[model samples]
Target: MSNKAAVLVAGSWGTALASVLADKDMEVALWTRNVVQQEEINTKHRNERFLPGVDLSPRLAATTDLEAAVRGAKAVVMVTPSSAAREVARALKPFWHEDMLVVHATKGFEIESMKRISTVIAEELGCDEGRIVVLSGPSHAEEVVNRCPTTVVVASQIAAQAELAQDLFMNPYFRVYTNRDMVGVELAGALKNIIALGAGMSDGLGYGDNAKAALLTRGLAEITRVGVEMGANPLTFAGLAGIGDLVVTATSRHSRNWRAGFMLGEGKPLETVLSQMGMVVEGIRTTKAAHAISEKYQVQMPIAAQLYHVLFEGLDPRTAVEALMGRDRKTEMEVMSLETWEQWHT
Candidate 1:
């Protein structure tokens, strides 16, 4: 196979991953729909709109044609927003070949079907769901482009495929680990955005670190509870895709979700916050999906529920916090059974 990899959509994350592949001495194709952005990346080696001031790798090439990007590529990484994942996958279906490894870095659920990105891609490609790998962790595109030391996990039901992905992206600056808990990894990656939104809202409401810590703690609990119900390994929630992603996305200044939630907590309306952020805040859309999932699965997701209300129902952020704090008390380990706790400890 040729040492060529394609990254769909030359957004911040996509561009950064493409750079990683380029650093690995692979020919990288960075695809963008915007003609101007493609020209800028090709000529100047910069994506000023999404990642300003960062010079992309010289080995990374930009393209506007999807087929040209994917053709003869060993791997195709889908980094489009969750909202556009299906459309982009459909566009790729005609060019995709069985020999190519498919991976997605998207971290949100489909609001309409509540399907994960891998599932959407599989449906679009008419491929087995298990063949798709999910790459996730506490990764921020800005830090990654700067060659920051970042560790992430790639998971798939097919262990070989996961290992293939691990080998593709592994390098000195960026570490890649393999896991088989695709469901857990994907769920953790997607669901943590909800808590990040809540954490940002808490901080914007002038709550101290103590309050934010409590939110993070309880938020992990809610995430683990629902994730376990959804057939994910509970231990995955404690791993990189779960707590690792939760901490970074909730607190990092580079986090669009946190920034958007902060604006909302500062009393900005949803529409205004979204308009000003100039990026898709996955948490807002994920909150809607999580709310529906919680209800459908009969899981209690007070944090996500509160976030859904704040984002969609126009509930006051402070009032939502009040509601969260005032909820009926329960045991800290309510979601964990005795057997599960013993298994974890032993």
Candidate 2:
């Protein structure tokens, strides 16, 4: 297993990263729990379920064993979805070697504890602050797999860790930037999806770009407020993981959160939407968690609050919009951070 790095997981994003690394001629092994996916990557060179129609490099080997994935590896990337990050990290703790530069490619906070993915990796994997790096931004799996131009952020307490990840993941099309605000990067990544869900709901209701634009702008305001209160640097939210991710996820058709919101706006039941979309809708669960975090910090998040009621309390989306519209008049800046928009009219 002597290699530049071994990826401890393989999903669309993971496979895309593997492809990028393999392009660099970096020896990388990808690990997956799905035997079928491993066979597909090894035999056919494509992952049909997660990354269809993309041919992966033969240099990128796939495996199912965790120990084999990490043995003699200089670095490791964990790209599983957020819900599975904790269990996977916990399982990998015994095999992880000291000095392994562990890069976390997953986003979203833990639902139960509202902890960010990097925190979960540090806690569950027994890694110190220097060992964990989070890579994020407006990267969609579809675009990345296609080798479309993309940019992302690498955040870690240690500059060396960030620089290591930046050196590995940066490419002509896929650029990587470094940041020290892990809290802001992780929070921005998770909270933007919540707002993207609401944006999709607005589209499902046939609301025009005006409404969707309003949601995106206002949603970012609340995200920044919560980030500031939670000890995240406010400027980080103004950058890639914050406003950058919000724009893409909220607008892109590839976004699962937006699709879920679209279904909700079209009057589909939550269970129906969930069943149709086999993948986990991270934002639907994150809405509840965001609402709780907002209350804990005394930060006002009206969009998240309404979304929480809509998704959980069975409130109608239209009525939710009306409630938001009919709330008592306040200065526009009080409710949102939009400086260029017209004041809400009665």
Q: Cα RMSD for candidate 2?
A: 4.6
The lDDT values for all models are 0.92, 0.87
Give lDDT tens digits, candidate 1, residues 1-346. 6999999989889999999999999999999888999889989999999999999888999999999999999999999999999999999999988889999999999899999999999999999999899999999999999999999999999999999999999999999999999999999999999999988888888998999999999999999988877778898999999999999999988999889888887889999998899889999999999999999988889999988888888789999999998999898988755555666567
Strongest candidate by TM-score: 1
Q: Model 1 compared with the native: what TM-score?
A: 0.97
Q: Candidate 1: where are CA atoms >4 Å away?
A: 336-346
Q: What residue runs in model 2 are displaced by over 4 Å at the alpha carbon? A: 335-346
The clash count of every prediction, one per candidate, is 0, 0
Model 2, position 313, has a per-residue lDDT of 96
